[model samples]
Target: MKGLSWLSRLAGGLVRLEGRKFTSLKRCQDDHFLTPSKGESALYIHIPFCRQPCLYCSFHRYQFHEDIARRYFRNLRTEIDLYLDRGFRFAHIYLGGGTPTVMMDELASLLSHLKSRLGGAVISLETNPSDITSKNIALLKELGVGRLSVGVQSFNDRLLKAMGRTSHTGVEAQEKVRLAQGNFETLNIDILYNLPDQPPEVFRNDIAMVRELEVDQVTFYPLMPPLNRGDPLPPSLKPDNRCEGLFYKMILEEMYDGGYQPSTAWCFSRGRMMIDEYIVDYGDYIAVGCGAVGFFGGGLYANTFSLDRYSHMLEKGGLPVALFRGLSRSEASRYRLLTTLFGMGIRGDGFPRRFGDSPSNGIQSLVGLLQFLGVVECDGEELRVTAGGMMVVSRMMREFFSALNRLREYCLRYGI
Candidate 1:
């Protein structure tokens, strides 16, 4: 246990160092991403408006304004057309917050445009618990949304209040879940764990409530607060990394005991289901909205986080991409390994097809180190995470997300 603790700290430090390299981005050129990708890619559309933003969130989001939101949706469509003109194709689409369902009319218009242009692509969307009304659910189903993820956070009213989530109470969230249970192909409920002032019994009861609800899937996210000043979460609501392993262990026992299986490190399901996090399914995704980030063709890029700049760029007939960073072969390889492992494991053969080299040739030493630590095991050409490695990977991913929040804070602060 001591050794695992040491490794977690070591991994966190290394990931933070790598994150610095990631955040140091350069000006993007139009020609850099013109060429079409080689494999299946998803489209991620960000809707950065929320009626009531959560205190624990660091996503790029603005307060709700109907006129501004309507204009933003128009600009968003223009950005999508830019990608379509570039010969990019997306069969899977994910719509993420700040509360994508805040405006039903705008959402319907956007969905109609996407279906017409993209041809019945499978759509996954996220919403707050308060937005799961009958009218909203009917519209989502009509729009052909196959997966709906509700950001429930927790079912304890005390925890909800502590997290500064006034959107819905414990019973209200459960009722919303009940309302949307069988309407979609997969209904995923998002829960946060290891929050400050959250007790073990609170988390335990939350998991038990999730099982009682019997939703299609449950995603338990470890709370990852921002790494800089002006954090959204108060000090009282900050996550305690020391308790993360304990929470994760409880998750493993309860979910498995409840007849649930892992679709990823953080997501558990009863059967085959679409997950909310698009990163787990598509290695390369095109992000096409203000504050959206994309990984493509060995480079990472982010659209302008400033809504004014984003609209201006689009209105002038240009993409809203503000920064791009071309990663080294080693860096790209490590990224693939990290995401794939987070989805549970990766086949060895996939490395060659994606990286143009075998796993041993590109990341053998890293894999070997993980193997030596008994965190992962290799059987012939297949590598998988061990039971002990789940928490390690969880911690590693938390650090990575914290790095992203740092980038988000930086961009929002400077209007980049």
Candidate 2:
């Protein structure tokens, strides 16, 4: 554990440094360059309107207003057409947001348009408990949504209140889960851990409830507070990182013992199911909608955070991309390694095939050190993360996302 702590600090520092590169601005020489390669890519669409934004969340979101949301959804379709016109094609689509299901008519319209344009793409959407009604479920299924992920952050009412989530209570969340279950190919429930004053027993009970409910999958996310220098979270609601590993260990032990399997470093499933983290499935993805981010052809770009700016850009017949950064060869290779490992393991020659360079020739020493530390193992050109290494990867991912939250905070603060 001592050694693991040291390693976590080292990995955290490295990821923070790397994440800083994403905050800078650079204009794309040609918007056409942002089009994803044909082979394997996904589309991420963000809806930034929420009824009430959570204090701990750093994603781009705004207070819900019907007229504003309707206009945003219309502009969202236009943005999608922009990508489609750029020759981007995707079979996997993930819709996430402030409350994707908050405006049903707009959502249905957007999905219908997607179906008419990009037929039969498997859609995965995130919703809150309040939106998991039978009507919504039928509408989602009709729209070709195969996976439904609910953001039931915790089933503890006190914890829920502490997190500033008031859409539903613990009992309401459970009932909603039951209501939505068996309606889709995969039913995922999100559970959060390591919140201020949240006890180990509370997390264990939350895991116990997951086993009782028998959902298709559950994603356990560490509480990552916003890093905006303004300190958005009160001290009473802050996340206690020191106890994060303890909660993670409980997750590993409980989930595995309950017949669940690790689909990714943070996601566990009962059997073959659709996982939420699209980066693990698609090598590249195109992000649409305001405040969206995407990676394509070795470059990372973000859409403008201001809804007005986004709409104006689309109105003028241009992409709403506000920031662009092309990663170097080494940085890109290391990124692939990080995400591949986060998905559990890297299998036979994936690196060489994807990057045209062997994994050994890139980030070899980092791999060597992880191997020596028993965090990863090499077997016939494949590398796998050890059980002991889960926490390390968890720490790495937490740091990566925390840095992203920082970027999001900056964008929101300045309306970039």
Model 2 per-residue lDDT tens digits across residues 366-405:
7788899888998866888888887888888888778777
Off by over 4 Å in 1: 1-3, 29-31, 226-233, 347-351, 355-361
> Where does candidate 2 stray beyond 4 Å?
27-30, 227-232, 359-361
TM-score (C-alpha, index-matched) for candidate 2: 0.95
Task: Kindly list the per-residue Cα lDDT of model 1 for residues 1-416, writing each as its tens digit.
Answer: 44687787787788888877877777675636645776557999999999998777767788899999999999999988988887888889999979999999999999999898888888999999999999999999999999999999999999899888998999999999999999999999999998988999999999999999988899998988743446544775777788888898899999999989877888999977445677877878888889888888788888898888999999999899998888887898888778877877766666446545555445878888998997788886677887778777777877777878888877877879
- How far in Å is the alpha carbon of 126 misplaced in model 1? 0.4
Q: What is each predicted model's overall lDDT from 0 to 1?
A: 0.85, 0.83
lDDT of 1 at 26: 76
Question: Ten consecutive residues with minimal summed lDDT in candidate 1?
Answer: 352-361
